[model samples]
Target: MTLKSVFVLTTLSLAAGCHGHDHGKSEGGKEGDHGHPHGAAAAELPGQSVTIWAQRTELFMEYSPLIVGQETGFAAHLTELPSFKAVTAGMASVTLKYVDGTTIVATADAPSNPGIFRPKLLPQKVGACELLVDVKSPQVTETFSAGPCQVFASADAARKALGEEAEAPGRITYLKEQQWKTDFSLAVAEQRDLQNGVRASGEIRPVAGKEARMTAPVAGRVELASPAPLLGTFVKQGTVLASIAPRPSAASDSATLAADVAARQAEAAAARAELGRAERLVAAQAAPSKLVDEARARLQVAEAHLDGASGRLAQYNANSSGGAAGRRFQLRSPVAGTLVAIHAVTGENIEEGALLFEVIGLERVWLVAQVFEPDLPRVQGARAAWFTIEGYEQPFVVDEKTSKLVTIGHVINPRTRTAPVIFELDNKEGRLRIGNFTKVSIATGAPKSALAIPEAALVEDAGKAVAFVMVEGEAFERRPLRLGVRSNGWVEVLEGVERGERVVTKGAYEIRLASASGAVPAHGHVH
Candidate 1:
């Protein structure tokens, strides 16, 4: 969250990623010099070490106090933020601004080792200097301004100004090199709302008003549209789905239908004109508003008759021919969606009002949960929910943004002694199926605000819930947690970690393996 001046930039709650390559050779051509993982700079840096967070990157830097005319080595651990991965390739420059306008700058072409960029500065001016770091990677160009920095005249002056400090106890060294090499991530333990949850068996279903069923309009044989719709074919509303040719009958003549449509059109136009005239007269105060309302009603009735007449004529205009046979009726989808089901096949004879096609929108879906009658009282004030499906390790969350509670059904099943609680969820990713069975965790009860970390951050050690709290860039502390109620991917921390502390979330397993290996810090990186 914060840091101070010097030849470094880093984030407080930082986890590192492994470098793509580390050849283990220092910049000075020495076997274990400044560039090597076992370099002299690896020893506990004597001056200020801070972690700073910028918009696009996190910098964890350590430097032995900067002395005039002396090569000052800075262990600049640069991690790309949000993803919390090490910066593999980039140019990192450290600038020290003096009281005068001039400055001292050091540059590193790439990571001294991946995630660690060593930029050495030889100061010419011995006074307090403002520190700034500029980094240019393939993905980002970011700068960080750390607070005030100090430059001493000599080693004695540096030693006297900042004395010795003790290292933290029980430090577990998990180097930045190891972090970059694995699937690692870091997150801050912050206050979150934790609630008691109720578990229920649920089924995914189509949302209301997003599905439609197209049926036969008359007794006829079916004729599918060109490039006929198959199951799962996406179709838009009012699109021609299929047509039904009625059996030969005197009343089903196409010419008669056309004549009826023309008559209906003329009647509709006359009614529309009457309504316009009535409205204008009412505005002029020459006619009562009741007459205007009656004319409007007559127009609506006429329009409805016209629609029916037009539909009959449209059937003949469609692909159906009524030579010696009756007219054909067209069946079109009323809503936009996928062709989920088709009950009739092309050229198949079917009766009027028989089911033909079923279309249902699936962009969003509903999870209908059956809550036990006894638990109804507890779930009345539900706050959030999560559901687990097959093949998914992480459960999908159901919150106000992504989902809504449609209803807690009033009617209870007499046999099952349960009520249906429906939750509508966005399914733009097509993850949920119409008939998927899922186990849902419905958060209920009053919310409790407490410090919490991701459930993935925890490691079961000696039968205790433990997590690796990031102590610094290259160090971590295995803290045993006293956990409270767990819900929706976060575990409440009753103890053992503080607010704003970063913990490893993704690679905790590998970090635990590193701890068990008992490898020296040199085995990992030059920390």
Candidate 2:
């Protein structure tokens, strides 16, 4: 054979050998690769691993568009999840499955805030649904399910209903506000106080003419012959309280009696002689008319003297026996009332003008209260007033006529710097006292209805007031609010918030913190 032919045949045998070896290896690799692309196609397909940061088992969740409010930062997280393999940006949907076998679907769309997935309402029912995710995978044939989402409308509400496990990460739950309608108190606007007023402490006091005192008119010993039964007793008109027997004036009585007896005896002797002379003069016809007249006049004078003597004797006898002498007069209550104080003792001598008894009529009582200078203007025009006593929390009506502003003191109290404003109140029940402190609220003006919210829902930072409103499920956005008057625990929301919007009331502090950390996303609402 020639040299060129020998070389060509050797090369041909080597080429065949190389080809056979390549064929065997390629066939073996093909079998081992399964259905996956051998080159770029397998690498080009998306890759993702199932990751559940945390699981909150059996959390009672509500699934509704209302749950996906504007405040929740849920949109950003949903959009970011699409970056993971097998998940597309707009293809994802979240559903809540309640323990009671109810379901609600939530869809993701382009959020106004970049990269945030604005949620579209799939339904309005608040229940539960399984969240299934379908993504293209090279190694797997079936789609992946995200297990169960513990969705809730609010963190605290969910925690209260489903316990602490509901707060687990990535365990979104919906809080149902079933109690929102019922668990609220209404501030109905009627004729109630509007502006702020100062509260001042004060007490009721007794006015003059309402209080009375009884005293002895003359010095005398107290007698037990009072018509009233007891010492601290009540006496009406004409009821004798007590009487004192007089001590005898013996010398004056004896002088008056002697003068009366002597005068009476002389008058009797003169009258007998005059009658005898007058009868003889008339029978004999010897006396003149003038003499007869004179005799008759003398007899008339004697009889007049005797009558005077008899009256004087009778007066003297009564005085001598200590019956007509200075004696204790019965003391009676000048007014009909309750016996409050009794100073006179049984069988004790009392000086004239001394205090004997004190009585008070409980038919009406004054309700005095202090008014601060600042609040005085508002109260001055109050048509009605109300007050509550310590023991009685029930407020009673105070009419303007019965409780007018009697006086406003010129001097303010040194400690309180408040003027003592007295209003006469009619406490016919006698429940009030001279020094019982009372809580008074005056109906100074008419009431008007205004948009209002609980003060707790507000977040005060610097001078601005803000509130976190629930947007989407478990997400909240901070919103500025214009505030007006505040009464009790409620504040009137003048602007930036409307009625019926679900707002973050309890967890505002935490929401603010989340917002500051950028953990909360500002997402616009679709519903």
Candidate 3:
């Protein structure tokens, strides 16, 4: 016989053996006794199965042998219908009621395997019976019923009925333990204020007046401050960054200027002495008062000359103390910021006014979003925005409360036909860097509430957007989704999923692969 025929015949025989017992009392028959062996019911019985679907909780229940005087095992799997993700923890109970007024109740707690519950129930008499299942989860309590079913005298009768029923296909069963082993995660689909907006490309730039260029003040050789500053180095305003000293050819001029300063100092000292002497003579009547006044005038004139010479010398000493050859001008940071560029290296000869270093404060930055000419009108109406930059997992938000719209360009670029719309963002954490390419969404319309999920939950299947939902605790169903506005890290779900459903937010592709490859394991009791 073929394998399929052999399997069927074997199952049928086992079913017949289980139910061939008499309906009368056994040798040890007591008040609840029936002919069938009680011990036999505890063992696995072939060809006897019944499955019940709980619509409220989306729980799927399957049991072996709807036969009296036998121990039946009911396996219940709980899932969230909307997302088709498994329900991991819940309390379950199964009550069997027979027409003869005999009732049996069995209870099972959540298993480590997740979403799978096994309850053992034993029926005492063969008659009409009803099965009632109650499941309690953290979110809700649900009850379900199956069968005003006939509790047959034997397993054979139960198997015969089961053979006529059809089984569900493509039902993937993943246990809780298995999920914990894999990179599985879930999130609730929730109602949120979704803003429909225009998407535009942009870049991060330092806010105006927040950046400064350090340039060489005079033609000289560069000497970097200790721990030479490089790109990305933080600096404070007034901190010396480098010193410049005049070249060899200009050393003589520096010396002459120094000599001139000394000459002025000597002359001012002599005049002050002469004025003191003249004032004493006038008091003693040895000199006229006019002579004393003339001495004082000479002192003032000499002091002015000294001041001018000192002023000239001070210019060269602006940065650092003078050396033997010339004064070394110390270049200090004009603003507190990070050094983003170094145009001149230490010991290199640079001409006056040459670019030296670029410092940019990162505490705040501007997002210069490029709005196409057609979308320029919408940009003016934008009240808020969220932007994502390359290499960042989270988006930065700008709203009227914390950010300001700096400007909207009146001129459009000839090549791209796009205008720059500027918004400033607080980057106190320094997570954002200048010149990073960005994608921005400017909210221009009124906010509306809708169901939404993380953008990561979405995947494309056969050219249609789909998401895996936990229908039963261990079973995930592939669902097609109709998507709407996308903003930040979330996408609006117009259809395919309901609020409260748990969808796979991580490792969905693995589940899809497992389903496609028929690698999903059978659901059973976990030790």
Candidate 4:
């Protein structure tokens, strides 16, 4: 499997079970205003006559053109007032009737854009007021009532009123109604191969099979008869390491020689007597059978003694002739491996069964892994797996012969709370080390395709999981979604989005802030 990046950082995907919040105003704001649930600045103005013009839209005019002049006493009053183009480019004259028996008349250039209108004067009555707008255009003429007007004498006062209005019922820009967005990304999962299934801290380990020391069976002065291998040397099975020569002291030398000679002479005499006895018995029809049998038995015993004497004498001669004064014993390697340690010096005497040397087999190595309780189930039946060594960063797969879990420690390790799970790894390629630590990953379950995205792409809004969907140019909308199984770096999107839609995969927070601030443009297609 391919990982796109190793150090990639992405946002965490909120689980489908979570929730998100919206901070926008409710949908009840009046027409032609930032009806966001959050409070916004109010419409500024002067109270006067409102009149509709003949043209539908006039560019850079004093009043909206789509509206016709309602011929009233106030409309006549506004015609005589100082006229200047309104802030909007295309507005014409329009007249409105306040419910309080007063009229406000105004003229603008055109109606290319729609916005709230405030005459440069306030109505006589206080509190809220509704006025009727008589709009006329080349195509059609329409009349509509404009609300519960919040009128103030100055811009600052209007702004304050707007704030209060925002908090009041039926106001737009409610904070609870807004939605925020975020982006997400994905990367490959890192892999490691632990051979000694998760090792726990402080687990007792016996020296490997060959690390134990083996000593000479008998005590003697040691010497190498040939070019014997020493400490740090490698030996094959049955290769002799050294030879030991047993020496004779001044007191024991003469006695050993005399006993040897006597044993030889006795053996010879006994053999001759036995041969004569057997021949005579056969000829005389039975010198008693018992006597002949006894003589033969004695002869056999004598011959064995003689053979032992000869072998010992030969050993002594070989040692004395070699500038050494003792019978030598050969110390051979019991197993094939490298000699790691030695306690014996060339001239030092060693006791029987004393440790002399240590050997190790390096052909195979162990990779130990510390299996955490949660991870144990996943690796239970894993036959083949791989891991990466820390220094090498190279991954090695467990060989089939050593892939099986050799052991699972019974007692939980108190320190690490991990159990030992061991597997053998091949070192023939020289790629693995006996004690190197590695990170491992096992394919615990079968792979299946699911709708997935980077976790970062999700954000919480009003306790719901949401992502930003890029709708029109530079415009994104918050979308609620449900999530499913996640693996590697990708989270499964179970709902609220479809494949191929460019959900914000990055810079989602900034986009959300802009939307809440009204920096985002509303689509002309919005209902």
The candidate scoring highest on lDDT is: 1
Model 2: lDDT to the true structure: 0.46
Relative to the unseen true structure, what is the C-alpha lDDT of residue 215 in candidate 1, on a scale of 0 to 100?
72
The per-prediction tally of clashing pairs is 10, 31, 16, 100
Model 3: lDDT of residue 254:
63
Error of 4 at 406 (Å): 2.7
- What tens digits encode model 4's per-residue C-alpha lDDT throughout 179-205? 211222212111222122321222112
What lDDT tens digits, residue by residue, belong to model 2 across residues 1-527?
Answer: 00110000000111111111110111113312111222332222221112221111111111211232312112212211112111123333444456676765554443222222323333333445454432221222122344444343543333344432112233211121211212211121122223332355666766646566766644556664434446444555445555543323332244545676787778777876876787788778877667667777877887778777777565445322233444235555566656777676677876656787776655566666677767766676455556666776245556676666566577767776666666677766677766677776555555556777665577787779987765333434566898776543456777867664546555566556655664323211110
TM-scores across all candidates?
Answer: 0.67, 0.35, 0.59, 0.33
Alpha-carbon lDDT, every model? 0.76, 0.46, 0.71, 0.45
C-alpha RMSD of each candidate structure in angstroms: 12.4, 27.4, 14.1, 23.3
Write candidate 1's Cα lDDT for 45-153 as tens digits: 3446667766667777766567777777667778786777788898889999986867888998987667777787878878878888788888557787765778888
Deviation of model 3 at 342, angstroms = 5.0
- Show where candidate 2 strays beyond 4 Å: 1-196, 223-323, 372-378, 409-419, 439-445, 448-527
